[model samples]
Target: MSNPDTSSGTLPSHEIIVIPPSGHQDRLLLLDQCIHVRIDVFVHEQQFSLDVEVDEHDPIATHFLLRLVPSLTPIGTIRAYRAEGEKYYKLSRLAVLKPYRKYHFGRDLVLALHRWVNEDAIRSGLQVARVVCHSQLPVKGFYAKYGYQPEGDEFDEDGAPHQKMVAYPS
Candidate 1:
């Protein structure tokens, strides 16, 4: 069944805030919110070990946090970083709470990240060729809906099956 939060046919008042790396004290607080969501969905729910869930890329990645309006509680998050010396950006750690999954928050998060990439690329006069993800095999189709194509055979990541997928901007 779809979440009641969305089944009513009325869009929920929510926002995806982009947390670009900057010199701000509150940046850690914002990142804590992103970490909380990831811990809930990735570590607790999915059983990924904490060591594997938190990685070196986190410090360099651009993070996104989704907050429901009124209460403004953080409920979803995702992050992306550019692949070294390459025209590719890698998206990772996308998660939405169980109740919020039906709201299409995950899809919105990806789209928002893509939008940010396009704008940043234009502003910096850099050509970004693609966005890539090491998606869990089960949800590869979710990324496909956004035009990502599988790049290689499935491989084990943190004891779970994952596959490389890439999406070129249209």
Candidate 2:
């Protein structure tokens, strides 16, 4: 596998994009792509259970698809949704294919999600909104780059240790 750390940070702006639900593709198609990437990343690569991979939240969550430019092949995905009675938005299911990971598409994916959350909050007439993700132990630092901080003690989720990270992205 190529080293994501040593790869170049720059990519042609037109070559990669993170898209929300729209006429560019059917909603179901977009979601299906999201699930495929998650299965590849979380289930196959990380040994997460398939049963928990696609949960009830998927129906209500706003999903984003990351596609390669021109060909528009789906390579990564992410989602954000508000849980019942929760005051903040929950971001989850972020995944990028192994080869594509070296391109830093994951950063763009998370940024798009944060932009959506902030815009959604503004539309709802809210002054503040927090976005939280259950970050796996190894990538907790990845979330921290976007201002997310560990909020509590680490615990097990999906048979792996994780930390509940919170980010107040404006």
> Of the candidates shown, which would achieve the greatest TM-score relative to the real structure?
1
lDDT of 1 by residue, 89-170 (tens): 8999999988777678999999998998787667767866478999998899999999999997999989999999999765
Off by over 4 Å in 1: 1-10
The C-alpha lDDT values of all candidates are 0.86, 0.82
TM agreement with the true structure for every prediction? 0.91, 0.86
Model 1: lDDT of residue 34 = 95
After superposing all C-alphas onto the true structure, candidate 1 shows an RMSD in angstroms of 2.8
lDDT score of residue 141 within candidate 2: 89
RMSD of each: 2.8, 3.5
Candidate 2's error at 143, in angstroms? 0.6
Model 2 lDDT per residue over 128-158, tens place: 8899999998999899999999998999987
Residue runs of model 2 more than 4 Å from their true location after superposition: 1-25
Per-residue error for 93 in candidate 1, Å, reads: 0.6
